[model samples]
Target: MWSEETPSLNNQQYQLLQELGRGRFGTVFRCLHRASNRLHAAKLIHKRHLTDSTDRRCLQVEPKAMTFLSPHPNILQIIDTFEDADTTTLVLELCQRRTLFDRLSDDGALPEPHAASLAKQLLEALAHCHALGLAHRDIKPDNLLFDDANNLKLSDFGSAEWFGEGVTMSGVVGTPYYVAPEVIMGREYDEKVDVWSSGVIVYTMLSGIPPFYGESVSEIFEAVLRANLRFPTTIFRTVSAPAKDLLRKMICRDPSRRISAQQALSKFIFY
Candidate 1:
């Protein structure tokens, strides 16, 4: 939960540089720390959007989640936070190598080995989050970023939720294409939702498209709920058998059967 009291630090401390990206409640900027002269990414959230409970919860959860789970190689590090009357600024580690979506857009589909390597990194990060009782409801390509060496780092924890070991979470959160079936069905779900999303990512990486397709958001939800789980020979012709087997298990409709992030790490190799 965020406090309404004005923070000691404000936006003036950082020199805003380039506009990095924009989200529902905030815009990220590559900024400079005036005192230390270090580069950082600043996510400035407008206070007005906090009117909605969901928005407010997201505002409260993101920083806390980042602070709790960071310093890991694959999770984005939150450097500092500043708040004012109009906005809340979160200073973060600047990741400039672009995102997985950019890489997929430019290169179409990645080779199996390359995709497996990135998938391993992402799964390792998810394992860390799940072990700490945090579920990153959104696990799409856009949230998967790369650093200078192209190491994968998971970002955007706004839709994330914290739960007890056996307890399940409720809510229809996450991108349609990557959302798990239980989520779309409005059933209580555990962190296994992440593995389903990761499975979709692997499918998209192997072929240049997702397993389920629809003309609209509703239609996509329909397809996701159906959980057809198919592989069109035209696209998946070159994908290895083991890789496809892993996708089948990961993307399985039943959350109980869905492979956990830690299990996926051991099963992810594609030689």
Candidate 2:
């Protein structure tokens, strides 16, 4: 059971405002703190939906994980957590500018410089998480939020894993297009999986399309497993050589050869 220390306020302490968005696990709403009148996003997850042990465990892990990365600027901050008999509510810092996915959808592919700037911030955040023995298995643009200042923040930890030395995770989890080949092959993998997803995100940011795509989920997975990564001349013609080099290192088929977050930050010339 979660303790009272996790949540400083209950339902009565805040007024729920407009709906922010919805995901497989829950719905997020823009909220107002009654006393302070400050804005926050509240994620309401139904307890009944988490009937399986794995699903329930993720619910428990999310708050703790958020607590672990709270001080990092590029990771979303959890303000508080609350629960009723029916649902669990998490109070979070609201990113009013929406997600990176929204930006891509509305503005098309980003210019290489802008993409590089966002990618650098993302790698910094991932580096912080990996240093602490955490792997954010999901790293799609949809999970990346932007604050009013347009600074990117990594959000959602439902698929995240915490490991110790020599420990590797084995599971087929994460979005299909972003999942690494090692994960699809059912091999034990570590934090490097995030690097692959980040690579896919960078590819999409520059090309307005994912490196692997298909008409169905199975086809997409097949493409991810066997497809060769290509930088179409139309898109790559204007992109920098250093940027392409970084992308190749990130999306390597062999996880062992995939660039670590720290390496990506130190070796690449994003500008």
Candidate 3:
């Protein structure tokens, strides 16, 4: 991981513009293609995150999802990908729009049109990945990217898996808050996990809080496993019935009963 003080890869040809932010595994910097002056986001992964067994798994799966989804307008662009002697670097499209996290923290609840727009962009990008037999496994506010126009883009699939006839579970992974109960419990899961996480994300965005929370992590996990969904009426009184209905379908505890992403795209509230 790069600190503002220490950038791992030493390519003097690449000019650093500024630090965008830091994530679990690394720092991202706004950079310029020295020769062309094109702006980009450069994701720098830590040497340990690339070499360690657990972190390596995250590193491996992230690129597959990124490369597969890179072409979509609703997905972060991978201007180029390269690995150094120590770290992995991705030259990416610079995103100017504030993160959904920032928006929710600042505005509390997003407007209906804004929520719908983000949800639509996310679903389309997700549908494209699912069609390619991939499972993002992790979907939350932090994973969504936005441009200067607030146009949505999907990012950070480090927990993704290539799910096909018989896929490998790089290991039980994903942030607990956004992870599906089945995946957390080590039960066999599929792309449906992403749908569940997306449900949580949408709920958070529209309602101004996550569907469930606890003073401690164990309680939070219990709530998720038991499907103890709650509503803070004060926060969601103005949300439409159609929106609530969609949330229920996406977050259904039983994967067998949950609506698929493609089916969700055609649902009533996909506006």
Candidate 4:
């Protein structure tokens, strides 16, 4: 729930268990709400990180987006929020399992069925975001977390932005491998950027590697700008033709030609 008044966040309300992970601005901890005795993930973003207007805008947008777009099974839900002079804490649903990135690191690639299942969930979540005028600028394996049931949940709205119909967003956002070509060219873009990133996720799931790569970040950007979508015969020999077709429609370099999240979700590849 959202409120104009900042509620005092104190140790009396929640018992911080342990650190789950760290991000650019905050440390996530496993916490228990004393009143309910229920477990939740608490991300305490320090005020010190609010060094610029951009940082502050992101801080404001993250919680607002989570609160407005959540209660979604495939999108991480925020239980509550708190504020103090030093920190802003977001109490979120606990997804006590590895991220999709961790699974990929350990298991290489997933079978088509498993990949399609997760991809569909991600797309559905994106569809929900786009419908609400929010663009998840950063969509990658690291942001895809799993719950106890291994359900895919899209998380981390630190880079999310709100856009209007027919309007475009500008910025060099998103992770290296999953960033869209339009973003790399410093062109104005829309929600389709997330679709491009999701396509990269699907490609990685099926082939065990990103379609574009480089020895350095610059090289990776160059490869992404080229936007050469390819499937190695040896690696993709077992992948079905429909899956490849779906990837082409999604990962296309041109945002105008790229399929929307809803369109990708309806593709036969998932069914």
CA lDDT of each candidate?
Answer: 0.88, 0.88, 0.79, 0.90
| Residues 232-268, model 2: lDDT tens digits | 9987899888888999999999888888999999855
lDDT of 3: 0.79
The total of clashing pairs for model 4 equals: 0
TM-score of each: 0.93, 0.93, 0.90, 0.94
1-271, model 1: which lDDT tens digit per residue? 2333322346577888777777777678888889999998888898986788888888988999999998999999999997877888899988975689888888888988888898899999999999999999999999998877778899999999988967889999999899999998899999999999999999999998888879999999999989998888998888899899999889999888888999888885445
Of candidates 4 and 1, the better by TM-score: 4
Flag clash pairs in model 1. none
Candidate 2 lDDT score at position 260: 95
The reply for model 4, stretches above 4 Å from the true place, is: 1-11
How far in Å is the alpha carbon of 46 misplaced in model 2? 1.2
Write the number of the candidate with greater lDDT, choosing between 2 and 4: 4
How does candidate 4 fare on TM-score?
Answer: 0.94
Model 1, global lDDT: 0.88
| C-alpha lDDT (0 to 100) for residue 4 of candidate 1 | 37
Q: Pick the candidate with the highest lDDT.
A: 4
Segments in model 2 whose C-alpha atoms lie over 4 Å from true places: 1-10
> For model 4, what is the error of residue 135's alpha carbon versus the real structure, in angstroms, after optimal superposition?
0.5
